[model samples]
Target: MDDQTLRRAVNATLMPGFQGPDLPAWLAAELAEGLGSVCLFSTNIVDGDQLRSLTDAIHATNPAALVATDEEGGDVTRLHHRAGSPYPSMAFLGHLDDEAVTEQVGWGIGNGLRAAGIDLNLAPVADVNSNPRNPVIGVRSFGADAGLVGRHVAAYTRGLQAAGAAACAKHFPGHGDTATDSHLALPTIGVDAATLAGRELAPFRAAVDAGTLAVMTSHILVPAIDPDLPATLSAPVLSLLRGQLGFAGAIVSDALDMAGASGGGRGIPEAAVMALAAGCDLLCIGTDNTAGQLAGIREHVLAAVRDGRLPEDRLLDAAARVGDLARAVAALPRNDRSPGSHVPDPRAESRPEGTPHLSPAGFWLGDPVHPLTAPVFLRLSSTANIAAGDTAWGVADHLAGELADRLPGSTCVDAADLTELAGVLDAAAGRPLVVQGRDLARVPFLVDATAMVLQRRPDALVVELGWPELPGAIGIATYGSGRGAATCLIRLLAEGSR
Candidate 1:
């Protein structure tokens, strides 16, 4: 192949992320040279206007280049990272079991992305959260039921695509049954073929039937299909998605920088080559990627083609698929919704009228009781998983101005700081105490601390901001820590105080 033909083919298969909010000079140059796509993270976003400008800049350099973001609209959000996401999580929607509401939420997320000039959204996680102890995909998933998750995935895909943003159902085959986080390690799904098809692959099949524009591969090992390689590097697995699933959309690989993909003595460049050979049309090369890294991956991909390890025809086919996706997205009617219009705080107007009265925000475990006359807020802090990162969560910051003096504000206590729990309990001596936490069931220390506090202040109300797995506690589970969930909890608390 000629040098220019080889360069364009290699560039079209890469979807890389770069540093900062503004477009870096090197990335701009690459876009002009035929880089097919770029993925955005929280660091590259400030607010809606800046994000729109960034995407516009990307398109200006290369109109065919796709702009993608992980705007899952719940726990894993990039557009609304500063303030939490305005839409309820997939778990909360599943708990409600209302397909219309789920579709509306999906449309809202896609509308926001479309207004921001983003083409693709890596979202609508199709995994069934079969394992409650799963660390990565708890609230991110719709639920444990295969049928429920599959239907919701289909609804979300339809809604998102209708709003002009392409939806990419992710972590293919399944990533919900494993205990390990794929970002940190490679998780193996040991289930048999029947279980895998009935439970894991069911939602992906639904997504394909729903005409989803793309599907993202996971860095997981399914012993039933391919024992040696993860799905991103396994031809048998990708072929299952392509042949059995009858999906003609672009196939995207999960970020190659994850330990699950690049670990075991292999670097990202080799992994990129392997992923393309495995049938991934577009490779996401992780977050905060540098110019040198992109160049190195391109070189390695080129070298692989020259060495006959990766066929030139295969490379061209992948690039063609990516081009087709971009062209499809470009052909859609322009979304004229004003930028930043869909991101309003959803506490008041967003909820559908006559909805189930399981409290306005979340369901209550017990009878409605206001045990607090004088209240002290205690926020239990724990290590956020790698996927959620260190983005601020909860309503502490939002409630500071309103309840500054009377409530004495919220005290943040680390999960490991067991000694401080006593002092916190002591501080709320003659008052009713309210505690907040995220995924309390997942953290042993947080669970023990919550139990210890409940022992002392039995009337205390627990507010769970993560997944709603905290049993035996008189609390409200918001199902997520996003802006919508936080606002609902805050309103509930305010009503009780009044």
Candidate 2:
């Protein structure tokens, strides 16, 4: 291949994220040179108008370039990262077992993305959360049951694509059963072949059958398939997706900067080559990518192709696949309107006049607890997972702000031990206590603290902002910490009092 052909092929497979809300000079030049895609992170976004302008600038530079973001609509939202998403999570939809509602949520998210000028959404986590302790995929997954996850994955894919934005079913071969976060380190899926086929592969198959335009690869090792390489760098795993699942769409690699892919002394550029050779059609270089890093990756890929380490044919195939997806996305109907302008108001559905509008964000565990009167919000905090980052979340703050007059005192504490729990409870000062937490079931200390609080103050209301598994607590599980869940929980509390 000549230098121009090689450069174009290399650029087509590279999807890098840049700093700031504006398109940088380097990135604009890259886009004009046939860079197939660019990923937008929270840093690149400010508001709908800013996002639209940025994406419009990208498209203006290269009309064929695809713009993508991780807008999974729940905890992993990009468009609404600052305030949290206004939509229910997959787990909430799965708990309701309503496919129509799930589709509507997908459509709403897609419309939001479409309005933002984004072409692709790397979302609809197809991983079945079989392991409750999964640090990365907890509430992101639909459910623990493979069938339920598959059903919702298909529904979400159909809805997202139907709304003019391409949906990419993610973390292929499943990242649900592992306890480790791939962002920090590599996790090995220890399940056998049959177990893998029965549990993990089901959702990917469903996604393919649903006409998903892209499938994102996970960075975990499946000893059942190949003991050495992670799925992002395993041809056998990619073949399994292509042959058995019959997925002809693009295979997107998780961020190469992740420790799971770049750890053990391998750099992002090398990982990009390995992922492409392993059958990934597009390589996500990582967030806040610099021009120097992009140049390094391009040089590494070109060298690999010239040295015959990565075949020219393989590079061409990957680039062609990316180009095809970009063309398909370009052909989708454009929604130039402002975000959420055309999407139906999910909360506007008919309800009895004067009754509280209970959105899908609220999932009642036990009976409705005693209503809030002079409530004191006590937050039991946990370490934020790397995937969710340090985004603003939780219902306590939102509720406190909304019901400031009713709230006497509100404090957030790490209730890691009995002493901390005692302090937290004491801070409530015998007022009607409302304990707020996220993924309480995953952390032993939070569970123990919550249980002790409930035992001491059985009248206390427990609100779980993450996946709800707090047994014996008469609480509301919002299934997410997004603004939607917070609003729903507040309405439920207000309604109960009335």
Candidate 3:
């Protein structure tokens, strides 16, 4: 790839797009000419072998192309396999509040992607989800606190990079505060730059300072900073991001097909060209563009360059940055491999073996096969009835007061001091424990750790507060807090005694 070729490749790379199964004939043509990268959606992933074959095909045509996806765990996982990777959500990781757990998840996810031969992971969402009602960023962000989310974001970036995958922190200038969805229409955040710097930008700054390889711009409008152009097409926003924040990594635009960018009445390719000229080095076509739409985007770029409407240098620079990103990603070492590769685990806890029934709650200090194990919380809250020692008691005070009255001998646990539970579980000889919370799967090891203790005792009962989709030794889903869970548990316990 010489400079001229690389330049065209970069421009093509910036014109990122996705296509469905038919793989439009023009797709091959675009690849041959250097259209940068293609993002994979759920539709693109048929099976592991098929996915690997697709990547091989892409590389065969354009060796420098960067294949990317929204492999962010939870609501936004792209490469889900019934058998391959343990698909958990960001909410699960966020609930556990354990960096080590989050880091392992990143490694697992990153490793799984590398095994599939994908290069870029547009993940570790850096949005500071301050708006609880925020339709888009719910559970996608690490948490509400800027510093906390920042720490996890940095950890995710480091872990992904460590596992030989490039991590992209996204929705620059923060999309978390908006009330509307950017997919349908442009969302405007009237926040001033200082307030944004304090709340929204902190996590991104942390990611940038940690040497993240990519930072994606949002499609939302920030009147305080760049009212004329959304962050995706605003030089001022880019200046703030690059000049003030000193982010030298590749600057990516959120999907050009998104209503926020396209709403201003520009066609897809026009948006792509504008994004590049506005300082975005990569143009994401998002995932929903039709085949005809994708081809149109390509033709638009080609026409722009041919007619001198879009300077060839702009496209070249964007592609250069993309190529540089590809080099950086390709240079990293690979993760070992995913456990089940492609076959879904029939015995996976999410899919149990028997009739839906509850198990007796007993603690096993150690082991997986033991019958009497302590109860595990699928979504643990202090409001439940699980006995806790005096020192560990009252932890649930942070959860809710209504839940506090139901558990006679149970105690509450705060999110911050959960490590104490690990220590308590370690020292217990064998006791019936009931863990709470619907987010157990997020912390794969914690679930394993809790189950390891249960194996030492097999009489463990797992209590789930949300959906009863996951499996457990003895599974119970009371659905919600309060009397429903309390009444069900009391009846189950009374029946067990009989």
Candidate 4:
């Protein structure tokens, strides 16, 4: 009956890596005490062998530790931190437009991650890219078309689940159509009921129908549902995802470290308590911060229970949901549908009873197209031209540096002086042009320059790295114009061209 133990069981963490096969004693201690999950990020991952060792060590301590990663397999990835994601983003897949192919891509991503000791993939972004100015979720989304995105969501969910890693359909209710990044500031979406039912909620409905095991909440404000609170700390919005959408899966929160959920001026510990009270089963403590940050969260959540801010039964319900998810991901059988109905099967997860499968070294993506490799993901430079630019001259230079990280020895240019930029475009000639920066719709220079380049190469891949998207590019979005995004986009472009 101790909330102390219960609180420990509900937190999912991003831990720093250790020297070798063994993790730090502190992490081992956290795992032993029933930490619900271990999240993998770029910092925590080095390569396949080291990551497997890390996960294996954690599993030894906690059988159901739920090893997961943000391996969306495109711009936003953890596995391909050092190299790059060999697979396509949801935007790329959506362009491919074949449901079976989308499922195949999802399976490939899951298969690769599972091979590296991941049991859950926080991927296949279910949000629709309905807004060009959405800074956080442009290329991460499948597409602007709701029905099409819904199809991909179900397909990707089914594929990942089939590949033995549970799929987490994310930003529940939808993070689409927002201008602000929750990481920096809270965003508000003021769509009416009809718009939500038609656009925002469609993909989630498909995800639930596809039997997704988990749904992560957005930190944005949806005045239509809950005006006063951000969705992560909003009981009404979560209830909508539960009662209305019929999602029986575990509901997790976006990282509590984000400014949106940090209670404006409040500490993260208080935010964690509110999130749990709002029906989040798993509280994601971002790995960017240390485990020390979680100590206060654990203590405060327990205090919330003792002081009646959070009901004891609600905490139990959350813990139960987390346990259910852990069991489900580990592929153990549960007789009851309720949370915590399944007891810990030490042997069940000890050996990781995954369906006999290999991490697909090379796999087919859209259509009967080319097979993709795991590491040296891209190698295409027929014209020796991968031109890149930014709206501002300074960012253009910075963008060029990042592009080189992915595309070696490619030409880089800043868009200034239409005549000079046009001359540069002429120099690129038949090569693929890569543009990085804000949404294309808002920036007149980019719009004009992109139009000029399209006259030369109609299929140039325009990417917005961690910012708004450009609408009319061959590929609508890639999360950020970093190494991961560039690698994926270049690969996609190479395959499509061939």
Candidate 5:
């Protein structure tokens, strides 16, 4: 292929989203123009059968274009709300303290994705949860312990690959200790090289050794390496993963729409250019990106290649890596298109890299599976849908006692009345403030309330009710506002403090 065509092919390597159950016409036009990939979200998912057809539509346009989704399978399954996933969050697997369990969870989740024609899973977050105040990667991570996360990272990678879906250990060079969510703002990893090498990079090391075929880069900044650019756009940072970690597979950038990528005066299109220049094989425009936005990214990257702003050789190499991933996905040994056909043998087929051989009884660890693991996979809490502030307040009051009983010196409040809430927030300013609510991004009043509280008390934490990303807050998101979720939060707070 010519440089311009290859440029369009490589540059169009975006995982953009569309509305409804199938591929919209606008996106199909762009995909025909050499768009590299498509990513599915909950909005895009109807069921496993529906997902297979959706990816088939993309395949019709470009057969080898990787159909990917963030089926993290625990708290962040893209297909679960519509169909369902058997796996829980990594925290549950981590808490289980069994690498064999983590591998089974991966196989179960991977089997679901394979049935749906989603070949690439941009998941098994390599981030270690080194900082509990991290806005994004809390329960999504295995745990705060370095060794535990590393062990499961290898296991998750092994299991997913064993189930015939390519595993991508993600947020590389680590997103574990940042206080910011890259979706909203650039998060700086403040640790030194030694600290990062020991804590954050441990799981990535394990993942690479476990033979993961792809690695996704984080948008967070690391001053220990390149102080200016985030890892997504930093050659040195990507080099560390490639050179020091010896990851010889596909390297992907986090979403270009993120503040960590587009923040600091860089636009999404330009960020895509920089990402390809920096060594990312795939430039993700994010699940929320539109057809026009994806087209623009393709156009700009092509211009960069033509004008020599991005070297042709570099783009060619990255494009080859991407093609490699597509080929890898194409080569998986599934018998049929049926999602359930690849149901992995938990004890025999989908074991982790270093996990010891186990008997069939160990599949459920000598207990029934569903009853034992339901708490980890199930939704934990719900925010009262009462639009009235006072009614929500009453609900919070009812739940506050349940949360308070779990941990001393902890309480919950509905951010309904600012004047009244401000007084309560002021009183608790000295201690850790944990605030959780639903649709936090949509509720301007709630967002403002949290921001105000954080302004006065810069140490306050905000947990989301599984909605859009919350900005400018240093806290963990439990993906729910229920009692069980609150207990998880309380446990995080208690463990973090000690």
Candidate 6:
């Protein structure tokens, strides 16, 4: 098999889409050229009807061609129609602390996707968000606990498969530990192989053991495994994923266009060649650059195989796997409808925004609350008057600003101004004194100071900003940023019936 033959074979399994000044013509051209598959992004996907028609048209072009998307039921959903399914994300489910609820969310997501003519869900992110500073994948994951995330991934896979759709556990080795975005640049993992085996690889292993249909490789570098190449282009990582973890499913490469995988040094075709050489079965290129960019790879892949740069046997093997997956999906029982029929979620009832919703208030956060903004508001305004000791910094000033605006007549006292605060408390003896952003673990003296303040005013309202179970305050957990709306709600609480 020469480069041309391998190029032809490689062209046979692409899940490609197109973009240009004129997209419809681009779509037609890609189809006529015998491109293998289509992936739907936010732009390519419109409503359910439009998506169904688009998928139908693509299938009509090549009856055996595969169509795919990344509709993971949260912010990543493609068909976010008003009539579409409503499934909460991993963050919400993780907060619920019920495995049963997690499984049900998976089932709803899978059924909804299947109804929408999408056979693949590039979902169930197996990455554990170990680094709090990670810009992406924060609450998108289950939680910081790897074991909990693994269990949820296994459950999600089962629920999705039960509904006749395939689930792909993503960022194969792990992407949660990295602080940098792979879309911008390559992130290197310094943890030893043993540490990876313990923390990073746990969820992936669980996913593989649960018989997930596909595993999408990450672009991050794991020096302990393959120092030079990222996992998506590393035979060692893919082999470990398949051989050691016993993952017999299809291995899909993350988008070749991402800088972590392709952009900085290599061209798309060259990266595609390297990826295929590294043992990936399916190549997923976004619509933005698939047509002209990969045009070179189509021919180069064929040439590589012919000249022994790529193995002909590997090409055939990969193609067979892709075909088998398609056949498996096809052989499953079909759902014939008006091409856009789906059952609605029974529990989806409208609740007016700003209504007081029951939620768990605590010092520590394990999972994100549903209707996330509501609980956030409740916590932020739960207390009335604001007070602080001397030595308060910018964080204290920020809290003071929030209090002065949100809670009218709220007084902010510096530690140097503690005497003034005591006088004011004496004036309104039983009114609540709100203490914000106290890190007693770092400054232990603050513990005694806070106790002294509380002792004088037993009616004081103390909001612990940092950890769980603050010794002398009501704990409000703001798991991440962008919780300002929640702060407003808590401020409203402080003004009431005092």
lDDT agreement with native, every candidate = 0.82, 0.81, 0.63, 0.65, 0.67, 0.60
Using TM-score as the measure, which candidate wins?
Answer: 1
lDDT of 1 by residue, 89-128 (tens): 7888787777766776777778778888999999889999
For model 2, the stretches where C-alpha displacement exceeds 4 angstroms are 333-362, 399-424, 470-474
lDDT of 2 by residue, 341-394 (tens): 233445445311111233643375566445566666666776667666656676
lDDT by residue (tens digit), candidate 3, 75-120: 4555652221233345445544666556766777787788788888
RMSD per candidate (Å) reads 3.6, 3.9, 13.8, 9.8, 10.4, 10.5
Please identify model 6 stretches exceeding 4 Å from their true place. 1-8, 20-23, 32-34, 81-85, 332-498
Q: How far out, in Å, is residue 170 in model 6?
A: 0.6
Which stretches of candidate 3 lie above 4 Å from their native place?
A: 1-11, 15-24, 81-85, 288-295, 302-312, 335-498
Per-residue lDDT of model 6, residues 288-378, tens digit only: 6645566766777776777888788888888777777777666654322112213332222332111112123211422222221111111
Model 5: per-residue Cα lDDT over 163-182, one tens digit each: 78899998999888877788
Candidates in order, TM-scores: namely 0.92, 0.91, 0.67, 0.74, 0.71, 0.69
Q: How far in Å is the alpha carbon of 173 misplaced in model 3?
A: 1.7
| Segments in model 5 whose C-alpha atoms lie over 4 Å from true places | 1-4, 82-85, 334-498
> Model 4, which residues run further than 4 Å from truth?
3-22, 332-498
Candidate 1 TM-score to native? 0.92
lDDT of 1 at 188: 93
Residue 410 of model 2 has an lDDT of 41
